[model samples]
Target: MKNEPRELLNNMFSAAVDAAQPSRCIAPFLPPPPRGRTIVIGAGKASASMASALEKIWPGELTGMVVTRYGYAVQCDRIEIVEAAHPVPDINGLRGTQTMLDLVSGLTQDDLVICLMSGGASSLLSLPLDPLTLEEKKNINRALLTSGAAISEINCVRRHLSAVKGGRLAAACHPAQLLTLLISDVPGDSAVDIASGPTVADPSTCADALNIIRRYGIAMPLAAMQILESGAGESIKPGNPSLASSDYRIITAPQIALEAAAEVAKAAGIPCHILSDRIEGEARDVGKVMAGIALQVARRNQPFKAPCILLSGGETTVSVKGDGRGGRNVEFLLSLAIALEGEDGVHAIACDTDGVDGRDEIAGAFISPNTLDRAWKSRMNPQASLDNNDGHTFFGGLGDSVICGPTLTNVNDFRAVLVLPKSADHQQEN
Candidate 1:
């Protein structure tokens, strides 16, 4: 019996995520044990796992703290694990940020600070600057998430607003040799963009943050706006002596994840075309463009023949016009399904490698030739759901939502579009 295409697609996704797991990738990049104390601290979906991975091979006694999104924590005995909100800031995250700051303060040159930074760290390390409350930071964060601003720009704002982000954490560890290992989830894998570069020097400024806020029309509190205007939130620049002893490396990224998926396709005798690992923009628009490419491959075989996978990885943005509960991956899948119009010989899957999409529990959703038809049969209006940004409920109605709780790793979004020949129509039903 031939393996099901959907199973293959799921396997490909698993491969992508597995390639970025902290345990597999973090070990090779681990720095040597310091001559003095080892203090580990981090914030992100994968930080907890990274800390746990560090504990296994680290030679000396390690004491540190890492904050991750709620429900994404892995058990660790020595290093404390704090679970908080993601894409949004909460009180727990605020308190955890202060504690993390304290953890690094007063360290001497003999101590070593290892920071495990990854995606979602900005929100997980939410400590507002003076005169800026956590509530204001949360409001700004929520606005930025729905503002269609690029991740880099959102992070720029985050760096300026926080007490622990944008190299501030690294600066706090001054005199202590700081090493940062990252699992990149941003499009370009800019170390400064990952977790707002908590352990790396930031080149962005308050003026840049103000410009982004203005460009996106994001409503900001007066005190926060004034802080940006007064230049009080200016981040530590590249030449800052406070960060002179810091070093960083991106242990894993979207490109690596996409390559892993491609290898899986190769093993299965399927031609895989990695369209791009840095595709960015509106999710629905990106979906439409991807749908067109898949159509061309199916109808003309121009780019490549059937029995191939068009894979792309990048973090897409969703300007929330409707009050719906769906992450960028599902939103893209919903839009792709609508654009495909139930075309035969095509199937697709979109999911975040971290196993959480937007603020929902589901990772993402699936798209098949019958996706639209099934929705119609179920009396679910796909367009209405899409309009309301309710792809979660839409796909849930058809039982197509891919739910795999926290995968404990993140390399950004993984998308696969499988186009088969007419001879393989039987596989579409399976």
Candidate 2:
């Protein structure tokens, strides 16, 4: 029996999310109970949820704290959950960061530090480098959000500017056994790039971070400039023995999520193809490229034949130059609809697994063959919307916004394209 379209789509998307959920991946990587105390620490959108999962599975005595985005907290008896700001630093986050740092300031080789790491850790654990006030960090963060820098570039700058990031936190707990459970959100899942790799070794140099800051034309506060110039806040270097005891495990990743979706497609009698899970850049540009790929598969059959789905995952950025609300996923959908204007038998959906895209309430947008046609009918100009970087508004106007509201676990973005066979009448005649 042919599966209902929406149900099939939901199943695929659900599989993608389930594949990356913390519960399924965290337990296997857990280390044997440390001889000494087990102190759990983490930061990210998924931090609290990860903590909860650990609590459910862990049978030993464990106590610690982890910072999570405000309203994203999960209750735990042993592990304290501190709600904080994300994508921008707030005083609460600063204080929480200090608390977390203090938690590991004195640990022995026998102690265990279970680090649950994921995306958004950078902002969630906001600690301004000394001499730089929290406000200064906020301004820099604001500028970076609007700077169109890639995740790696943004993270490079953040690692240099932060106090607990770039492996310094783990270094503080020298001699302790550090087992880092990671949910890979960045394109490459580089520990140094995810949440700025708070307790992980960093290969990024001070020079690389400075270059990104300058390239983005961010005006720094006097204190920030001084900290960098003095090199007073260097991260753990590659050979630092302080982090030698730390072990890393990827609990969930985009590739794993995409494969789950592919499996669903196969089970449903639908062909599946996954584009690069590492695609990045401006949201609109990436959307255009994806649209082109979809058109090829739909019209030419040069790649996989019809009855196929394209699954992809990655974090995309938007350089916000307008006031209208923007989200990377929504922008991608708009660009895609415009590119595929009126094309038959193609439908797509793009959403952030975290359920919040660029400060917007909606996760993403959906597109059908008539998406562009409907926009025109409603007197909406697709190009104008694109020009303003207002994808959230465009999709909202059509009531097509995918609102999932903080799935409580994040694995970056998910995109799917469904292609059906073209009519024989429309087939190109030789």
Candidate 3:
């Protein structure tokens, strides 16, 4: 009763983001000084900050390039930081990725290649394989995003189309000691799914990419299709000698962030249930399932009693059937609002840890028991907005959207539903 539900939710979110920042989690994982020149290359929202952290304590010469989202760049003296478009590939990203690939090429056994890949790398490092133009890669990327395909599925296609993704980047560093450190933004923390596993062994084949395209009905450039069908786009498979000497590890992941948030709740004397850090599905559907659990806790206290928080993390997808502004976090929160129907004793927040959800700069939104009622009074039709995929506008009108621009970390989505029980709410109000 001492901390309001909304404030507690916000605190938990901040804790989650703080736990994943590069400076907080990158130091202990830094490798020892390499024998030869150390070339660092990476791409993601966190790459620039990661590079900066490495430079602060690195004993060896650090020189290389890393691509980050347009506004997420941090000052790094040694590594060149290239700011580029994210969630969508651009010419700048393409150039940066090509340069990275070139830097790792022609390395000797004594040379070391350090990769710092994270979420958004799949788009930030966008050099298409030959015979496939950048324009073609861009088109397929757009399609996969709107096609409601899962992150792993989308990344599979990206790996096959790119010259730098999959295990090819590590392959390019053959004979050199290649070490990849990632801040995982994909569910299950599959090494092969994080930024399409640029420096890890990829077990997926070109056939898997073709299957995803067909399953999603994604239209690919004829040239790309031909490459896949002819097996020319096949990714470097497991057991490939090029990756045999490479080492890969995740320094930060969704699970780590979620557990950090859970600790905050525990210290506050609130029982916290960490359901999973690998949940995935359509955002709205996941919202409904979450609402059901919250209802049980509120009305029956079957799973967890009052004054508890249910925490989860992972990337969720949006099919984007409507013409409205769509951020997966907002989409999930909106659907949750509708399902809960002003149900008392339940308050929740959903956000992407990176501070950008879907295509918007807005991180995400929040929902309270009165969310729907407030919207109805303001003449905002929640259902209509949801139908148009306009959760941002709907939440914005109510001044409930949680906007924390450019947290500069990517661990995927964070959702917290606080079930207070009727007694706690009354106590807080009094």
Candidate 4:
């Protein structure tokens, strides 16, 4: 606990990632590298790394393809690694997606489709709606990103709108034993919600997708709307018999990640309290609540005592009403900072393990007693930054943005609030 906040923050983040490491998650569940043709592949932020892990564990001449976010790709042999857009689909994603469908087109039941999927696959494995072009899908994706819809809601719409997502990917490999290993980033960790459940059966209906689109006010193109409204194409449902031969497993998830972080803190003599692995809400709103909790610990010590770190996970949403470039984590931390209002003896960190928070390069941010003071001296207004939805700029101006690039694995957000009782020495220093 005596370690510097930055060092402790990095350790906690690393520990969380290690807890959900694909290599560990992919081991026991790996089928004996199918006797017939063992095709290994998938798409998402962690897919390329998962593929690499599969190559090491499964002793077979595995060959297949996987698409990951542009900067999230890793090197692997036999299995081709394709880089594409994420949270938004693009032309490269379209090409890689076509390859997946084509790869499974002629495969026999003897062929094993080892789909290494994780968060972001829904966008990374993009294929436009039949009548709508890729550009149209892109517009809808942009709308969805800014719409502040939950991951599940956005993916519900994505599954029905795409040709490669939903259950089509698995259906294409019909008769083949499809084994999908997922690293869940969704709140509930539903198989169908992860990466739009590409290889898993989806129970979400066209109406479900349409309802979410309208709920989020995503500006669906006329073509997109007609597709959903007309029900021209549908995603896999619960009772689909084609899923009989498919296999599904959640290899890793936010729960494990949060637990691991808690363990590390406990070992370090800091009491770690887990809020929930499924926590979700408006980023700033969640931040306020977390801040309230931290204040309780700092002021009242009702829930926990001093020398404790409050931790929580799961994705949060940011409804885009402001012209800010910051991501959910920063937004959350900024809100938390504002709530604390330069309170002493409490420090915190909020970051995405995937190294990307929302669409920004910063992994997250650090908040100390002087956070506001630093922002104020820099001529940056905390409320103004928050108002503009530009948390990224606020922290960036203070040089406090924690940018780790892409760690390539996502288990959602990791928030740590360090609560310390006011000390006489600290008060004197202040």
Those runs of model 1 whose alpha carbons end farther than 4 Å from true positions after fitting are 424-430
Per-residue lDDT of model 4, residues 1-430, tens digit only = 6577667766787899888879877898887756678877689899989988888777777788999998887888788999988677888999998998888877777889888888888888878768889998888888888888888888888889888778888888888889999899888888888888877777778898888877766777889888988987588777688877898889989989988888878777788898888888899999999989988888788799887888899889998878888899999999999999877778888898888887777788888989999888889899989988898888888888888788778888899888878888766886
TM-score of each: 0.97, 0.96, 0.97, 0.97
**What digit string (tens of lDDT, one per residue) describes model 2 on residues 158-258?**
88888888888888878889989998899977878888888888887777777777887877777767766677666788988888898889888889989
What would the per-residue lDDT of candidate 1 be over residues 387-414, giving only the tens digit for each residue?
A: 9999999999899889998999999999
| Clashes found in each candidate (C-alpha, N, C closer than 3 A) | 0, 0, 0, 1
In model 3, the runs with Cα more than 4 Å from the true position are 423-430
**How far is 263's C-alpha from truth in model 4 (Å)?**
2.0
Given candidate 3, what's the lDDT at residue 185? Answer: 96
Q: After superposition, how far is residue 197 of candidate 3 from its true place, in Å?
A: 0.7
Which lDDT values do the candidates have, in the order given? 0.90, 0.85, 0.90, 0.85
Query: What RMSD does model 1 have?
Result: 2.2
After superposing candidate 2, which stretches have Cα over 4 Å from the reference?
A: 423-430
All candidates: CA RMSD (Å): 2.2, 1.8, 2.0, 1.7
